[model samples]
Target: MGAPDYFVILAEMRTGSNFLEESLDAAPGLKCWGEAFNPHFVGAAGRREMAGIDIAARNADPLRLLAAIRERTDGVAGFRLFHDHDPRILEHCLADPRCAKVILRRNPLDSFVSLQIARRTGQWRLGAKGTARMAKIRFEPADFAAYLDMQAAAAAAVTRRLQISGQSAFHIDYDALGDVEILNGLCRFLGARGPITAASSRTRVQNPAPVSQKVENPEEMAAALAELSAQEPFGAGRSRSLEPDRGARVPTYLVAASCPLLFVPLPGGPRARIRGWMEALSPGGAPPLQGMTQKSLRRWRRTNPGHRSFAVLRHPAARAHAVFVERILYPGPHCDMDLRESLRSHHGVPLPEGPPEPNFGLDAHRAAFLAFLAVLRGSLQGQTGLRVPPEWATQSALLQGTAQVLLPDRLLREDMLAQELDAMARPFGRQASVPPARTGAEATLSRIHDPALEEAVRSAYQRDYMMFGFEDWRPEAAG
Candidate 1:
């Protein structure tokens, strides 16, 4: 309550985090340790230990290092946390109200260009006396688009965690990093007695030229920027021309009529079973409420005093296959005919002109699914012309979108749905067994699935696998 016991600068690579750390360290009794949770090294590059905790020890228990930093420091202690750092420590930091959050951001284009230059020049940092290395890098639209998506995802995750926990963070942009007053204010936020007299001069800005001057293919870069600006006018991640942002699908939220329970549904998951379970919770088996807006959702929450919200997650492999079969491989009421055509012609997905023939068997299914996965890899990275439907978008991205309106209190996995749902329902004096697991798609997938398919799915949904810690899909593991 009296200033955070510790602090973390939530940041990403090439976002001036190092400069901010230098500035914070200038204040007396305000210590900003380097990236203590960076998985590649202990604290800083080429270092193995920090505050007596070595790399092996820290990996075994990151909290041991955190404890050391808090206990050994003479004043407020903190570290920088990039988006790709150890997520276990990130979870602990976000959950602890005593951990002050400093959110740092830069323009996605600038950061992307800087990162590319750094990668080419092998110059990540520049000292006052060190000579700066200059390099002109080629900008690839697909690569930049992927970079934007990664940054957006990271920012959304942090924002949602803070919002749900009722915590606030000090946000500073890249251009403000050199302001002495701003640096002093950050020191005050950390409860430091002394003010930062000036911004630290230990580090120098590595790149100071216009983006056009730094990129070799300036004309292509300009064209790409124009296209991106037209597509995402507000900025990266706000909107997309190719895909309807999933956050706008709040109307899909379902609430129970008989009890204070809200179900935030993620498409391509076990929705039918979950909906039936919600209905069964009612005294006379009334249908669950649907078609909720933000205003209506708030009213529902107000009227139901002790409402609990939840969502279920399906394995990426299973989810992707289900979507491919129902929506892509075969025609259905929900299929986008235009998208199917684009996938077949532009993305090299081999699809029949109509529904599959009787001769279409496991081998045919396997080949088509693999080709679809290749397209999925491109579609997710913004290289394809097709829209990314919620049915097949990464679950992590969908959950981020869900956080914009309502973050579920519990996120249960499909494999553990039976027990988890029972436990959740008991607290509200309503108990209903989950309907039997649906195995139609799982049965088909089992026949065509192999290590190759698993690897292909992993390539397409790498973020989901990393975020959820999902293992390879085994038919026996299917619920």
Candidate 2:
């Protein structure tokens, strides 16, 4: 059989990628693999799972994967493109020039916001062994500024990778392309003509509590949840009501600092089999990295006492806020882990049994971020029994000042992005992490119904912006 002309679709998750990939699948001769290295013995058999399916063995090597890809897609037509978001997928991308490239990017603010949500919600990419790989491989910008700066940094990384390759490719903006236009554009980019339809992007994951539908088959949903829960990475915690924060309370350490912004104490998949592979490829040869087991991670923190070498956590308020906003932006199927479950698991406090709820949108996020500071500040000022560790103040100040101060308002407004610039700015937010002082934004808000107060809401953005090195305002403040 003759080798078919193939195109590779590259981007991180939830960037309208599924819609793009499925468009190729719509063409009669065209076929798309969500994760090309994923089983079905479609490619070379470097490794075999218990089910006897071939999978990519290492993250460092791409020729084997490319060879497998060439071996695949023979005699296939219309369009034979492989879609994936993992950074390791780079090897395969660079390997074959015959395969056209299609790169997708979203607004920096939206993407970072989505990632934060994904962390809390446990929603992950199905492309690269799921979320664990996706998190590590994410090319999004997160340069030391608040969430916004980090987002810009992530965007920039994608741009750099695309430019370095310098291949003829299609670049997509998630906000710009509509369903019909995107699919159609992808067809033209790959030089394949086909009928594009909305059904191509139809997802199997359904909403159980969609507003109008009185669920006729509750049992099916329950069964599915049970099945998913059994395999869940964090496992399931107790169920509770999603009622407004009347009864909800987040943890002190999480809100106050002592953890990185993107922390998940819960383990992902199994322990690392060969961390040495990454070290070999990495500049410093990062030690034989060990993927920790959940039991061990939890136990080690307990025994090590002062030493928390695993599951370093931080940015509860920001992360939780991101989760809330993701719902409004991308209303897909329910995420893997429920929020109440997290409250129970992290704090060892269970909730009363009840139906689970979805994360609210951007407004919820804004409120949460503010409340988190308010709560933490109260503890720090010795209002609550909980004492705010001094480090808490430093981290919060860094986050607030960087995101609000250093960066431009455009980054946070919605859909504004400079991928490369954003990627370069991420390290700033984490630089010199000290407990920062948290002033109560709530007290001021509580007193004023004035529109100027709304303007004040926008003012805090300067603190965060400064960390990212945004705008003309202040390099002096960053130090």
lDDT string for model 1 (150-228, tens) is 9999999999999999999999887667656777888888888789776665676676545666788978887888887
Q: Which residue segments of model 1 deviate by more than 4 Å?
A: 1-245
Q: Give the C-alpha miss distance for residue 158 in model 2, angstroms.
A: 6.2
lDDT per model, in order?
Answer: 0.82, 0.35
What TM-score would every model get versus the actual structure? 0.53, 0.32
Q: Write the per-residue lDDT of candidate 2 for residues 217-332, one digit (tens) a residue.
A: 33443354355356532111211111111111111111102221211121110012112222332344444323444454445456544332212112222222233223212234
Q: Point to the candidate with the largest lDDT.
A: 1
Per-residue error (Å), model 2, residue 314: 48
